[model samples]
Structure formats: structure tokens, C-alpha cells
Target chain A: MGSGLLVETYVFVLAVFVGFQLISKVPSVLHTPLMSATNAIHGIVLVAALTLAASVRTPGGIWVAAGAVFLATLNVVGGFVVTDRILGMFRSTKRSE
Target chain B: MNTVIQLLYLLTAVFFMLGVMRLRSPATARSGNQLAALGMAIALAATLWANHRFAGGALIALAALLGLVVGSAAALKVRMTAMPQMVALFNGMGGGAAALVAAGDWVARGPGGAAGAIAALFTVLVGSVSFSGSLIAFLKLQEWIQGRPIVYPGQKAVSLLLLLVDLAAGVALAAGNLGQGPTPMGLYSLLALLLGIQVVLPIGGADMPVVISLLNAMTGLAAAASGFLLQNQVLIIAGALVGASGTILTQQMSRAMNRPLSNILFGAFGQLRTEGGQAVEGTVQSATVEDVATLLAYARRVIIVPGYGLAVARAQQEVRQLMDKLLQRNVDVRFAIHPVAGRMPGHMNVLLAEADVPYDRLYEMEVINPEFAQTDVALVIGANDVTNPAARTQPSSPLYGMPILNVDQAAHIVVLKRSMNPGFAGVDNPLYLNPKTQMLFGDAKASLTQLLKALDEV
Candidate 1:
């Protein structure tokens, strides 16, 4: 692998580790907020995956990059959908007398 | 190529941190969401830029457009009321995607890479289970399926057997034995499916908040497993965050319900009607809207405590209306929202917000619980279990230690309910017998409407 590619890979992996570590320290009460934030990170990962896939020449590299893109996209979109749905359970309505 | 990608990664991390920081308050949550979305868009664009494969840019652009259209439509179309189901569906999708990835990886590897094979196996099992389990939970919440527990003889043993089979399949897959591999994998998935079904089937409507928390945790575990399979640190980290948060929330919820986690998991507490259950021995006092209206109109202070019953009846708007009327009369009105008032966390808050109730008027269980003592009247609408005095007074009761609204401390308590049926925890509320408490038996919405009408007259 080229030095540039190697450096990018390290940064990506390091970012993931650091992000998780920092988020792990978040208090339990702040989960919804933390989740909302991490969800954005997942989006970034998705974009990065696509970019890596595009630039990589090797077949294996292309496949892995594509896979990363899919997984990361799923994480971001899925998180929001789930969070919104969970929030909906609390909507109160008037009862029939 | 790498410099650009690295810059994108750095930007993504910054946005992620910003979003996480913004989540500390509800006021900034929307902004946080937008920031995260922006970060994700940047990341996607960067990835597309990096790709050198066949028309990678076109495919990325196409995917982005498709995603934007579909996502925007869902965001615009889905009402806040249907959010929980949406969350479940999305969680299922995440799990499903992870499982598919594992499957694809396995197929690509030709079943020879032992480590990859094991990781794939774990990911698929966890992901599939979470996917199916979350779907069932969504169904239960949506009332697409019954929320009541479905139990027959030997149900626990059956669940145990299913779990055992799942474990056995994991062992076989890890051992690189494909001879009977597919069978066990299929069986493991089936058992996980049943586990989801059986686990949720017995829980009552009241337990949905906890169920959501539990399911959220499951989804996290699934994601983390998928991360391991893909050797992706970020996935693992994100998944762990979700899993741990969900677990903690579940514990807090369980505590709020005054039940041990074991009882919640294995006791099937809400499923069966206790045998020899007799009608609660109490002198039930009844009231009319006129009487309630009179009391509220003259009262120096009134506290409203809402519960799942309120949500079920969709009485939040009427409740808000009632509050407005009471406020106009110079009655000091405030809401006493229990921590576990609705099916999920912040359920009551969300419901009240929809009614355009001011954020200031709403008080958490801890804040309002103490104020109930000095309050002249505690108006409980369609709330049963959370306000039950049994949680505080009855040691033998299932909800004995659970924190309640303390509505019983008020000089006068008004409870509106459809019937005297026991709550989800299957315990009778002794608060109904309190001389100061009066039962207004009817649909909560209708009762509130009548009360509002009577208030107008008063």
C-alpha cells in the first residue's frame, strides 16, 4: 500500500477508536444525544468508505471499501429512524369518554 | 487521494463530536441532528471522490439522490406518534444489513478463512436476532400484534432449548465444520426469532418503554458484532455505546417498575392473571365532571399526573386545554410527569409537547413528586399503575419499591380509568380506596372533555 493510503487508513481506524472512547464516557442520561451525534460520524464513515473505494485499484480493496460504505450508511440512517420511532411512543392523545 | 480522504475523516470526527456535545440539551438536539447529517454528507462525498472503480462517482451520486428522496419522504410523512415503529423498522434494517454483510463476506471467503468465518457467524446470529426481535417489538408497540404475553406449558423450557441450539450452532460454525453448518445456522436464526417473539409476547402495554430500551441494547450488540466481523473500530465503538446505554436504561426502567431484572426476564409477570384474585376490597368513591370542575375551580393549587392511560386515550390535548382553563382561573396548575409515565422514556413529555403545552409547565417525577404533599388536588387522567399507592405502601406488591407520582399525598385525588383492572405489573392499586381519592370511570378523553365542559360552566 502507498504511504498516503496507509496514513489515511491509520487515521480512519484511529478516529473510530478515539470517537468510541470519548463517546463511551458520556453519561447514561445523555444517550439520546450521544446517539444523535454518533449517527453523524457514521455518515462520515460512509462517505470515507466510498471515497476509498473509488481511489483503490485492487479488487479486494474496492470490495472492502464498498462494504464499508454500505454498513456505515446503514448505521447512520438506521439510527435516526429508530430514534425518531422511539420518541413517538410518548405522544399523548385524548381518550374517548 | 489519501490527503483528501484524511481531511474528510477529520471533518467527520469534528462533526461527530459537535453532534455529541449538542445532545446534552433538548433545545439543541435538532441542530445536533443537522450537524451530524452534514458530516455524513461530507463523508459520503469524500468516499465517492476516493473511488476509482467503474462509474463509482455516478453510483455514489445516484445512491445519494435515492437516499435523500426516500429519507426526506419518510421524515416528512411520518408523524411523531409513529416514531417508535419507525425506530424499530430502522433498527431492523441496520441489523438486517449487518447480517447480509456477514453472509456476503462468508460467500466471498469461500468458507475457508476460519477467523472471518467465525466473525461472520457471530455477526449474522446477533444481527438477525436483533433484526427480528426489534420488528416484533415494533409490532407490539403498534398494536399490529398483541402486547399481552403468550405462554403455554413448558414455555421457559422451550426458550431454553432454543438458546441451547443457538449456542451449539455458534460452536459448530467456529469449529469450521460446514457438514451440518447451514442447518444449525438456520435453526439458530429460528430460535432467535422465537426468543424475540416469546420475550415480548408476555409483556403488557405498560412495559413497552423498558422493552424499547432492551431492544435498543440488542441492536447495539448486533452492530458491535458486525463491527468485529468487518474489523471496523468505529462500528464496534458505536455499537458498544448503544448497547451499554440501552442496558443502563433498561435497568433504570426495571427499577422504576420495582421489579428485579430476573423477574422481568423469566417471571413472565404480566402474562397470567393471578389465580384466586378477588375484587379489591375497598369502598370505591365515584365523582362527576361537575364535582371535579368545582374542586379544580376553587382549588388553590392543582397538579396533573399523566400515565400510559392518557396516551392510550389520546387525552393530552384535552389535558392541555384543561390546564389552560385552570390557569385562566388563576389556579396554579402544573403537570407531575412520572419518569416511567408512558410506554417509553419521556413518553409523557412528548405527548404533552404535541398538545402545545409549554415546556416550563412540565415537571419530572422527582421534581413534582415532592410537591404533591402541599397541593390541594392531584388530577390523574387515565393513569393507573404509576399513581398506585401500592408502590409505596404495599411491601408484597410487585411494584412496591417503584417510585410513583405520590398523588395519594394530595388532599384530594381524582383518578380516571376505563375499569378497575390491575395495571401491567398485575397489582391492585389501593389508592382507589383512599377517602380523598375519587374514581371517574370512563374513557379518559371523553372524561376530560366532560370535565373541560364542566370547567367552562364553573
Candidate 2:
């Protein structure tokens, strides 16, 4: 138990490094799409909300979980769909079409 | 089972990383987004399986379905012009979810230890701030609220006081949890929300892109804090990725404007309407749509620069039509895109792309700036600050250090605007008064449509 927080801290620090390295090279042209796409990825928090939703033993818990799940899912679904729509515009195609 | 779930989470994190990395190019960005979505779906499925208590599955499914319909509708139906506000809304929702989830956890399980309490406190505080800040950003972008900075006497001091209270409450809450005593969770939550609104309310519309980017990073950090409370690795990974990417994007945008992050956040810019609406220091000239059309017809080369005005008028399609007509006359037409153009990064590109303009024809500032001198005609469409010669000539101007399009260097310049209203920064554009410049005053779309019609008769 004493070592748990330290382990999590190590994971957090390492992930921060990985994140900076991974996103450092994205071009300016793709920044909007990249932001939207990353916005979708952060919707991963929806899973936590859903996990909380699935164990609703009390009415209060049920409402809280449901609201969290809904917002999280909105972030996930909206973020991804919007990214896809924006990226569709960026796809190279014949000009006349 | 636990090992399998952890490995699945690990795999999801890898996919998330790959998604962002692939976005480095235009070619691979779509597939990268798809890959990341797949990771999210997988993480979601794993969470359901791992956390399901069997009784609440149906309700959970129902909530997911509701979210699916609402979110997809917003993403699918929103026009490209309004995409920045939509992004703000979505980012805010993510932050809202992180805050809500942390609160839910607190209600269900209370605090576990010093670490849990601290993580929970950070999550709620940061998440609430991101959520509220993003909401204000959305409203500003939507024009539901004033796009200009709304400031009051001692606003910064009040904000500072709120920050102090929030920090004190956070300490009390964390200490209480450590001592297994009563927590001041509600006080911290209220202060967090207030702090977010205060922090974002004074930033003007011109700085929205930077503000949105910063909020995006805050949401990511908040999500990571939620992951800490729940001991979840995938949330930490995805959140950290967004945090990093958003931070980098914010810095890039700030650099493009030649401003520091601190100034962008705290600078109550766009509030000074004092000198912007004043009489011009020099002679001003206005041109009709027909006059601009004739100029365009004979021009050997034309560069079109677009700003938020073009987006507001929904004129990209018409602008494209004008470009086509100019092309028919053997005019070499290209678009000059400033890095910080429009309300978001790559905003003008997306708007032009919607009009089916070839991506190749869009030239970034550095790539096309040198060609301005050679351009026979420079058409400024609803663009202001980016083309202001004040950036280059007037050192004391608010926009002095920012990079601007060299439209003033063109042989001929025509500006389409509704009025002489200053741009988001509320700084007067000397480019409007340049000797070679001509203003075609009207809504950008209407002017472009009229220009297209006049060209047809030419």
C-alpha cells in the first residue's frame, strides 16, 4: 500500500515523457485535426464514468454515474465524429469534385 | 483476468500514441484518428467488462446510447464555420465528465488516503475550471456573448483571491482525508468553477484559439488526475497525450502571435475600442464590387487572404467560385494562410477545404509571403490583424511583433469587410490606409458573390 502511490507517480511521469515525444512532430497544418482527435482520445475518461455507472447500488450513485457516463460518452462520440468530419476535408482529392 | 485487462489497457495506450504520431502528416491523419477511436472503444469495452455489477448494465447502455445520438448529431451536423465552437463544446464536455466522475467517486466511496484525496481534489478543481472556461469560449465563438474581452476594475485581483481560497480549501480537503476527518469538498468545487470562469471571461475572441488549446490541456491533466484516483493507466496515457499535444499547440499559436503564454492568459486584450473606431489618420479609399472584379480579371496572379469575417459570412464557397472564375481568365490564384488565422489553428484551411479547394493551392505564411511582392493583386477577404502592416512598421502597436501577411507589398490590394471595425485585438490596421490598398465594404460572401457575377459579365 505504501509503495502504490510511488508506483503511480512513476507511471504518470513516464507517460508524460511519452506524450511529449509522441506529439512533438505534428505539423501546423494538421493541428486542428490533431487537436480534435486528441480531444476524442481524452474521452477515454468515459470509461471511468461507465465503470462508476455499472456498480450503482444507491439512487444517488446511479444519477451521478449516469450523468458522468453521458458526458463522457458525448466527449468520446462527438470528439471522434468531429475529427473524422474535419479530417475528411483534409483528404487530398480532385479539385473539381 | 486482471493481467489481461491491464495488457489490454497497455495496448490501447500504444494505439493512442500511434494515433497522435500519425497526425504528423496530412496523409495518415485520418487513419490515425480511426486507430485512436478504436483504442477508445476497446478501453470502453474493457471497462464495462471489468466494472459491471450486472444490475446497472442496462442503464449504462441507455446512457451510452443517449450520448451516441447527441454527440454524433452535433459532430455531423455542425458546419465547418462553427467548428471551433463545436470543439470547445466537446472539450468542455470531456472536462465536465472528469469532474463529475471524480465527484461520483467521492460520493460512493469517500476518500481512501492522502494520495486519493489529493488526486481527487486536483481532478475536480482542474476539471471544473476547464469545463467552465470552455463553455465561455464556446459562447464567445458562437457570438452568444460578447466576443470582446469583458473586464472590470480589479478583475485580476479578484481572480487571484479566488485562487488563494481554492488552494486553501484543497489543502483542507486533502488534510481531512489524511486524518480521516470531514472534508471541505463542496467549497473546493465552488471555488474551482469560479476560478475557471474568471480565468476565461476576460480573454477576447482573438485569443480564443490559444484559450481553447490551454483549456484542452487542462482537461487532459484533470483526466490524468482522475486516472490517479482510480488507478487507471489508459486514462493517464490518453490524458497525458492530449495535455502534451495541446500544450505544444498552445505554445505554437502563442509564438505565432509573438506573445507569451502568461500574457495571452492574463492580458485583457481586445477591450480597447478607444482608437480603433476613430477617424483614419490618412486618406481612405473604397472600391465597388465591379471595380474589384475588373481588377481581378486582368490580374496575372492573385493571393486571397481569409479571416473570421469570411467564416461569419459563410463565404468560402463563393470565394472559391470567384477563384474559379479568375482561374478561367488565366489568373494564378492562391490562398495565403496565416498560422493563427481564424478562431483556431488550421481554421482557414478547413473552411477552404470545405469549398473543395485543392490543399496544394493553400500556401502557409512562410511559403507564400515572399510571393506577395510578385502578386499582381492581393485580395483580403474579411481578414484584418494578420495583414496589418503595423506588425512590421509600427513597433509600439499592440500587434507590432506578430507575424502578418505581406499584403501591403502587393502591387494592388482589395479588402472585403463590413466596416473599418478593428479586428479581435481592437488595433487599427494601417494596412487599411496603405496607399495601394482599397476597401470593398460589405459582407464578405455578398461581395464575393457580386464579384463572381460581375466576372461572368466580363
Candidate 3:
């Protein structure tokens, strides 16, 4: 559980490598969904958004933080749902028309 | 309890990685998306529990609920034709959220230290830029704004000046303390958003895939910067992962068009031909629907080239019907899918799939290219730029060196188009005028229906 700037950098770099290995193999047909899925993953920014909302004391800060939470959640929820819908359309040769 | 929260975060990151790995195959992609959603649920729960003591709990819940409802409803309702801008809008929102979070940190905690200040500034800058840039991309794709590149006087110079000022503000805020000026962060954030608009304004609608991908990467990096400011491992990991994904897609989309990312953003592609098609030296032979139907009905093999115009006219169903008819006539038929055929990467595949076109018959540019030479007739529907022979033959043309479909190699070429107007890139197609080419000009849907009727009579 120990943390520091260096540890955070390590996590970032390693996660990037993992992302490359995982996403590069996605064929062109699945690109939109993949982009969308990754977009949903980053909607984890809602973490920071929620924390910021909790920390704010003034009205202006609360409003800004609320906007943050809303947008992040929209990104998270919309991104995943749409990706699923798009993937629903993709049928291989085995599937009937 | 702190240790437990950190472990939950770790678990969420693991789920994310596993989910992305599963996305490599279409069969597993749906579950993969659901898995990532599960991870998001875990993260949300953990965040709620960790911040249990904080005020504004009701506000947070309300905002999140509204987001959930709105996002899901919009996602459920948006047509497949509008997917690119929908994704672009969501990307913008994420970026906006990141910027707001960073701004919140700066306003509340006053930067905390030099490193924190820098991270917060970066988050604010990149995130805001991504937000505005993506919104403009949305407007362009949606055609709320003109699809052509909108260049103004001193565009680059103004953007450079804005950057210099933003840099000055960022330095002052980082080197000194927050509240040092009458809104240093505000100035920096505003300038960043404007810079995004300035950068994206010159790029035409045809380059939307690259712009959207680039903005996606920017949003991810902005989230990571917020992670540094807040010291959150989950933010760092997930943000980095998406940053990498977006970067890979951006590069691949650029490669498909044979252009560098720099050229895409900076090249004023449609500016010169905004009035209409730049007349090339060739006599275009206009054909009746009967002539095309006769050509197609007699052909032994036919390859279809579709583009954004096909999507615009909602002719995917008509195209599928045409394919079936041609197959019944013992004509071998396949679709040539350019990587950038529609508004986004793999856009045509999704459209075709939605129309229930069998997957085996849809071929990518590289695989289907050589077949064009032997094809008896190439049926081009609402596609222009991709099938342009000038892209191969004219060096002075702006679209020179861009990889294009070799429809010119086919024994006979028949195009269904609305007018002689240029495509999204605003470049005239010489393919319309080639000696063997026959153009059937009308709205794509109406033209396809007429052609189908004529197929029986011819």
C-alpha cells in the first residue's frame, strides 16, 4: 500500500505496456468498441471527481465538482453501453442475417 | 480500512486489464465491456465508502444519478450513423470532468506543493483542451458546424500566443502559490480550451477519426495528471492504459490514410475547394440507371466500394439487397472496406454488420485491392475520395500519396452519386471522368432503388 511519485510513475508505465499488448491485437472491425471500452475505463476519473466533490466547502467549488462528477459518470456509463450496443451488431459468418 | 480500499482499487485495475485483453475478439468483447463496468461499480462503491465522512454526499449522488440516466438513455437512443460524434461528445465530457477535478483541487487545497501544482496545472490544461476540441469535433461530425476546414487569419499565430500566455500562467501558479493572481488557473484553463479549438478548426471533417483519437489520448493523460495531483493509483493505471489505446488507434487511422498525425491536424484539406469540385480535365460520361443495371446484371464479378455518403444516405440496406440480387444472378460480389471509409475507423464494417451483411464477404482495403483488377464491374455507392484515381496519378493534388481503392483497375466502374461535388475532403474525383466509368447521379437511396428496378427490366 506504500505510495510515492515514483511508484505512481511505475504503475503508469507498466499499465501503458499492458494496454499496448492488449489493444494492438484488436482487429480494425472492433476498433470503435475498443476505443469506447478504453474510454469507459478512463471514466474511472470519476474517482477523482467524487473525491473533489466531497472536499469542496464553497458553493462555487461544489458546483464545479458536481459538473465533474456528472460528466465523468456520463462518460463512464455512456461509453460502455454504446460499446455493447455496437458490438451487438457485429456478427460473423456463422451468425444468421 | 485504508489498506482495504487500496486493494479494491488494485482489483479494479486488474479487472480493467483483463477486460481489455478479452476485447481482442468480437465474441468476447461484450462480456469484456460488462467486466469493465463491474470494475467501475467496484471503484464507485469503494470511493463512496472511502469518502463517507465528507459533506455534499447528496449532491454527488444526485449528479451521478443524473449522469447515469442521461448517459444510458442517450447511448441507447443514438443511431449507429451518429456513433462517432456520440463517442466524441463522451470523450469531451471525460476531459471536462478531469479539468473540473483538477480545478477543484487547486481551488480547495491551493496546490499543496510544487509537484502537485505542476500536475494540477497539466491536468487543467490538457483536460480542458480535450473537452473543447472534442466538442468541436462533435459539431463537425454532426454537421452542426461546417464539415470543411475553417481557416482564419493568424490562426496558428494566435494559438501560439495563447500557449505562451498559458505557459506563463502555469509557471506562475506552479512556482508560486495558488491565489497569487486574480485567477491564474482560470486564465490557463480558458487559454487551453481556446488552443484546442484553434488546433482542431483547421482540420476538415474527413480527419475526424484522428482528431477524436488524439483527444481521447489527451483526456487519458489529463486523468493521469489528476492522479498525480491526488496520489491515486487507480487513476494513474486506468488513465495510462487508455492513453496508450487512443495513441495506438490514432496512429493506425493515420496510417490507413497515409498521412502523419501532424499533417492531419495542420493540413487545411477542404479550404481550397469549398465552393465545389475543382474541375479536372476529363469528360464525365453520365449514365442512366438502366445502363448501370445492364452493366451490373451482365457482369461476372462485382466489388462494391462504399463511403461516408452511403452512411449519409442510409443505403446500407439497399446495398445488402443489391448484393443478394447480384449473388442470385451468379455474380460474385464482395465489399471493399477502406479503413477510413466512414466517419471513424471500422465505421463501414459496423454499418454493414448492422445491415446484416455476412462478415466473410466484407474485405479490408489491402485484402480486396488486387481483386479489383479482375473484377468485371465495380459498384461504387456514395463513395468518392476513396475511389479517386487522381490520388494515385496526380502528384500536385492534395490527396496524392493517400492509399486508395484500385477501383480504376476494374474492367468497368459504375458510380452512384448525388452530384459532382467533392467529398468531405473537398477534393474532386477524377474517377467520375475515366473513359470506362459510368456515373448515375442522384440521392444514393433513390438511385439504388431505381437501379434495382432496372436490374429486372434490363
The residue pairs in collision within model 2 are: none
Instruction: Give each prediction's DockQ, rounded to 2 decimals.
Output: 0.16, 0.71, 0.79
Candidate 3 regions with alpha-carbon error over 4 angstroms: A1-3, B177-182, B274-280
lDDT of 1 by residue, B96-173 (tens): 556655544454443435555665676677667766776787787788887776667898888678778777866776
Q: What tens-digit string does per-residue lDDT give for candidate 2 at B1-458? A: 89889988998998898888888888888899999999887887788668867356667778889999999999999999999999999999999889888877876787778788788888998999999899999998999999888899999999999999888877866666433322456567778889989999999998988998998998899999999899988888788878888888899899999999889889887787675333448877999878888899999999999888899999999988887888888999999999889998889989998888877788889999999999989999988999988888777788888998999989999999999877878888878888899999988878888888898887
Q: Which residue window of length 10 is worst by lDDT in model 2 chain B?
A: B177-186
Q: Please provide, for model 3 over B1-458, each residue's C-alpha lDDT reduced to its tens digit, 9 standing for 90 to 100.
A: 99999999999998998888888887888899999999989998999898865567678779999999999999999988898899999999999999999988887888777778888989999999999999999999999999889998887788889989888888878877455533777777889999989888888887887888889999999988899999999999899989998999999989888888878887776675645434688899999988888888999999999889988999889998899889889999999988888888778877888888876788888999999999999989888888887788878677778899999999999988899877766678888889989988899999998888888886
DockQ of 3: 0.79
For candidate 2, what is the DockQ?
0.71
What TM-score goes with each of the models? 0.82, 0.95, 0.95
Model 2, backbone clash pairs (residues 3+ apart or across chains), number? 0
* Fraction of native contacts under 8 Å reproduced by each candidate: 0.12, 0.75, 0.83
RMSD of each: 5.9, 2.2, 2.2
